[model samples]
Target: MGKIKLTINNRVVEAEDGQTVLEVARENGIHIPTLCYLKDLTGTGACRVCQVEIEGARTLCAACVYPVREGLVVKTHSVRALEARKNVVELIVSNHSKDCLSCIRNTNCELQRLCQELGVREDAYAGNKTPSTFDEVSPGIVRDTSKCVLCGRCVAACKKIQGLGILGFMDRGFKTKVGPVYDRSFNDVNCMQCGQCINVCPVGALHEKEEIHDVINAINDPHKHVIVQT
Candidate 1:
C-alpha cells in the first residue's frame, strides 16, 4: 500500500497504509505501552494497554490493531489514554501474585518492566487472587499459573507458530485462564515440549524445569559422594 500521512502527538508522520498505529508510533519513536501485542503475531488486543485516542473516534483504539489512515490524528499519551492504560495494568495486578522478589523472571519479566515504566507503585484494584498452580509434571517445562497475566503470547506461540493447539484459552473475564486443552496438565497433552510457550511468556508463569536444585541436594547429602542418573 502507499504511504499514509498521519499526526501522532502533534507531529506529522508517514507510514505504510497497511501499517498499524502501534507500528507507526514505534517506528517514529513514539512510545506506546502494550502487553498483549507481540511483533509479527496477529494482535488480539486483549490487554487494552496500548489504547490511543483518535481525533475522530468516540473511544480510544488499540494501537496494535488499528490500521493507520491518511489525515488521521492520534494522541498517544493523552490524559485519558494514560489513565486507562494505568488502570488496565492495575487490574492485571489485582489478582496477580506480586511476589516479584522470588519470581524466576525477576527483573527480566515484561510485566515487571511495564510496572516500573508505568510508575505503578501499588496495585489499586485488589480482589480475590487467582488460585495458584505449579505444574511440574512435564520434564521439560514448569508452569506457575499464579504469575500468568493471560497475555496469550504463549498460546499464540503454541498454536500459531508451532501448529500445536495444545494450549488454549478457557473461561472468561477474571476467571479466565490459558492452559492445555480441557485444563489438563501439559503432560496429558501432545505437547511438543519445544519450549516455545515458555520462551514467549512475559512472566514467570512458564519456565524450564532446571536440575540445579537436584545437583545441589546431592552435593549436600551426608552419605553421598557421587550421583548418577544413568
Candidate 2:
C-alpha cells in the first residue's frame, strides 16, 4: 500500500494506505483505547472502545479496523465519540463480573484500565450478571468464564500459534462462551498445555493454576515435603 496522509486531532500524520485509523493514531502518539484489538492480530472491532469521529461520516467509526484514506479528517477524542465509547464500555461492564478486587488480573486487566481511562465510576445498567463458572480442571491453566470479555484473543492465539483449535466460541448471545469443542472441559480434551490461551487472555478469564495453598499445606504437614521451583 502507498503512503497516505491524514489529519488526526488537528495534527497531520502520514501512514500506509492500508493502515487502520487506530494503527496510524498510535504510531503518531495518539492513543485510541481498545479491548478486542490485540497487537499483531486482526482486529475484531468487537469492543467499540476505539471509535473515532471522522469528518463527513454519519456515525463514529471503529478506529481499530477502519481503514484510513488520503486526506481523511478524524477526531480521536470528540464528545460524541467519547459518549459512544463510554456507553459501549458501560454495557460490557454491566454484563461483566465486577469482582476486580479478588480477581487474578486485578491491577493488570485491560478492561479495568479502560474503565479508569474513560472515567467510569459507576455501573449505568447493573443487573444479574451471567452465571459464574470456574474450571480448574486443567493442571496448568484455570478457566474463569465470568471474567471473560469475549475478546477472543485466546481463541486467536490457540488457532494461530498452537494450531490446535482446542478452544472456540460456544452457544449464542448472552450464553456464548469460549471453550473446548463439544462443550467438554479442558481436562477432557487434548489440550497441549502450551499456556498460549493463558498468555493471550486480556482479563482473568485464563491464568496459571493457583496451587499455592496446596503447596503451603503440604509443607506444614509432618510427613509431607514439598519442593519448590521459581
Candidate 3:
C-alpha cells in the first residue's frame, strides 16, 4: 500500500494505506489505549476503550478498527475520547468480578491496568451481573466466565493460533460467555490443552489449573519423587 499522510493530535504523520488509525499512532509513539485488540490478530472492536475522535466523523471511532486515510485528522486523547474510554472501562468493571485482590491476574491483567489508566475508581453502572460459570473440570485449565470481558481473544487464539477452534462464544447479550460447545468442559472437548487461550486472555477468565501447591507438597515428601513433565 502507498504511504498516506494524516494528522494525529495535530502532529502530521505518514502511514501506509489500509493501516488503522491505532497502528499509525502506535508507530509514531502516540498512545491509544485499547482492549480486545492484539497485534497481528483480527481487531474485534468489541471493547470501546480504544475509541478516538475523528475529524468529520459523526461519532467517535475505535482506533483499532478505524482505517487511516490521506489527510485524515485524528485525536487520540481528546476530552470526549477520554471520557468515552473511561465510561467503557467503567461498564466493563461494573459486571466484572471484584476479587482483584486475590485474583491470579491481579496486577498483570489488562483490564485492571486499563481501569487504573482511565481512572475508574467506583462502580458507575452496577447492576445484576451475568450468571457466572466456573469450570475446573479440565485437569489442565480452569475457565471462569465471571472475569471474562468477552474480548474474543481466547476464541481467536484457539482458532487462529491453535487451529483447533475448541472454544467459542455461547449465548447472547447479557447471557454471553466463552467456552467449549454445549457448555462442555475442556476435558470433554478436542482441546489440546496447549494454553494458547490462557496466554491471550486479557483477564483472569482463563488460566492454568493450580498445580503449584501439589508440586510443592510432593517435593517436601521425602519418599515422593516429583517428576517434572513438559
Evaluate all candidate structures by whole-model CA lDDT and list the values in order.
Answer: 0.89, 0.87, 0.92
lDDT for each residue of candidate 3 in 1-66, tens digit (9 for 90 to 100): 899999999999999999999999999999999889998875878988899999999999999999
Instruction: Highest lDDT: give the candidate number.
Output: 3
Give one digit per residue, the lDDT tens place, for model 1 in 1-230: 79879999999999998999999999999999888899987588988989999998999999999999999999999999988888889888888888889888998988888888777888697779876677999879998888889989998899889998888888877678889976788898999799999989989999998898888998899988975776
What value of lDDT does candidate 3 attain over all alpha carbons? 0.92
Candidate 2 lands at a TM-score of 0.92
TM-score each candidate.
0.92, 0.92, 0.97
Error of model 3, residue 10, in angstroms? 0.5
Cα lDDT, model 3, residue 113: 93
Candidate 2 per-residue lDDT, tens place, 8-90, comes to: 99999999988999989999999988888887764788878899999999988999989999999999999999999889889
